[model samples]
Each structure stands twice: as structure tokens, then as C-alpha cells.
Target: MFAKLKQRWQDTRTIMKLSLDAEQRALREGQQHPGAEHYTLAALDLPDGSARRVFARIGADPEAYRAALANRHTAALSAIGLAAANANVTPAGASSAADGLAPPAEPTLLFDAQPSGQTLMQSLPELQRRLPAPLCGAHVLLAAAAMAHSAAGRAFKAIDIDLQALGSAAEAELRAAIPS
Candidate 1:
């Protein structure tokens, strides 16, 4: 039981480290408030007596993990873009959307929390809108942290599933069956 717990702790830390790297990239690229890489925060679970080491010690099958991360990162960015795009879309039959509705407000992006629980420096307009409403006022700043973690989890799981089904042809077969 202790061994299982230890492995879980290690896994969580690995994921966190990867997410941190991604966030840094966003910042370096001039993302004033780089959005969270993951949509959920993972709770660490270090086991009692577990050996301590620098967070960088964990690995994710290197090649497979990187490819998978790339795939998910692309998808996540696409999703965020899509969400941004949707903001531009007229609320459908709601002509008021053209000039009203606050123009969807630029999503102020920023992590909701930090590794040390410190509040983020600032929030981006784009990221600020997608946040959970209830969390906005009190936890808006912390939203990025939670979202970053969630995004990482989602990206990793989604990419792993896609890689697993590669070349299966099941998607093509399904598409062929659909009516144009």
C-alpha cells in the first residue's frame, strides 16, 4: 500500500513539473498572463518514508510523452482558440450580441495559484472569463493554477488515448459510414 502511494506521489510531481515548464514557455513567449496548461490541480500524495528528490527526477517515457504532450497542447490551444472564436460569434438570433454583451471581454489569462500558494502576478483578460463563476471574485487569481493542472491532465490523457488508437482506421471507417 505504501509503495502504491509513493508511485502516485511521484506521478503527480512529474505532471506538475511538466506543467510548470509549459507555463514558463508561455511567459517567455510574451503571454502576459499565460493561461493554465491544465484545467485541474492535482493534489500531491507523498508517502511516508518515500525518498525525497528534486522534482525533475521523474520521466514520462520521453519520446512517447513528448509527442503526446505536443498533441494535447495543440488540442488544448485549439480549444482555447475555439472558445475565443466563439466569443466573436453572434449569440445566434440575438442581434444584440453584435454591439452588446460586453464583446466577450478579452480573457485575462493567469494561473490561479502557484507552487508555493502565492497569488499570480496578474490575470489576463482572456483567461479571466472562462473561469468558474463562483471562483471568479475570491479565487480568480488562483483559477490559473487549477486550470493549468486540469489542462495538463486533460492533455496527457487525451494524447495517450489518441496514440493508443493510431492507425486503427476506426475513425476512417466511421467517417465513411456517415452521410455527407
Candidate 2:
């Protein structure tokens, strides 16, 4: 009898694992903290493939997403004449995101935490309360979809992605992931 009940509540392992993976992804991108883009990148690599399918359904080459993400950051940084080909962007006197530094006096872009990134991370606690327990890759996809005006969004648009379709696919993926 409890087996049926147990199945209804998913464990937090998925979220925890995803979090670690997101952080690792951020580190690989030379960021001190995981941001929305890193989370989405990690989610696309989830073993379940739920997020991957959602993206593929909308014609994204899932495998190329990592490179695309990196390229977005590269393009953004390069636009300002920074040598951004190599993603190791930490510079001396740069404020670590962990310190909650105020925006730079000069126009600057923290590609790591794109303008929309904090909002995406901030939404997690509330999303946890509203979404099913043990949020999965699909949930990450949903969070990303919410950031439609972000760098990741711009990257997708450059590739001719249909944002509306992406949002719909994210919803469908999440619903399918929940146990009935």
C-alpha cells in the first residue's frame, strides 16, 4: 500500500544531482556560480532525456546546445572587444557573484549570470513550491523558457527557434514526467 504512496512523491536526488551538475557546468564555463544557462546546459545532459526531447521536438540540435551556449557568451563578450574565444573570463578586480556585487559602473555583461539569470535562480524556491516534488530536467527547461529575453533566448532566436513551441514543449515534457 505504501509503495503506491511512495511513488507519488519523487525524491530530491534529481534536483540535487542537477544542481551539482549545473555548478560543474558553470565551472567548466569559467564561472564562479551556476546560472540559468549552466542549469539549462546541465539539464540537456540529464540521463532521462526529457529536456533533450523537448528541445529536439522544437528542432534544436540538442548535442550542439553546449557549444551554442558557450558561443552566446563568447559573442556577447566579443561584442565589447574582449578576447572571449576561450571562456576563462575571470579577470582581476572582477567581483565574484557570490558577493552580490552591485552592477559595474561601466557597462558590463556578466555572461555567467546573464541579466535574466538571477531571476531564474530566484524563481526556484517558488517553483519548488508550485511544481511537482523532485523537479527534473523538464522543470529546468520550463525555467529557461521563462527567460525568453535572456542571452540563451537570443541564441535560440538566432538559430531560428520557435520560442512559443519551446514553451509548449517544456510544459508537455513536465506533465509527461509526473507520475500519473
lDDT scores of the candidates, listed in order: 0.32, 0.62
Q: Tens digits of per-residue lDDT for model 2 on 1-180?
A: 785456334434565566665665555445566667767776777787888888877778864665566567767678888876343453211224432432222222332343465676567556656655346677777777777787666666667767778878877776666555
lDDT of 1 by residue, 10-36 (tens): 544543453453343333322333333
What is residue 76's positional error in candidate 2, in angstroms? Answer: 2.8
The number of clashing residue pairs in model 1 is: 26
Q: How accurate is candidate 1 locally (lDDT)?
A: 0.32
Once model 2 is optimally superposed onto the true structure by TM-score, how far is the C-alpha of residue 47 displaced, in angstroms?
1.4
Once model 2 is optimally superposed onto the true structure by TM-score, how far is the C-alpha of residue 67 displaced, in angstroms? 3.0
Find the candidate with the highest TM-score and give its number: 2
Residue 56 C-alpha lDDT in model 1: 15
Lowest lDDT 10-residue stretch of candidate 1: 48-57
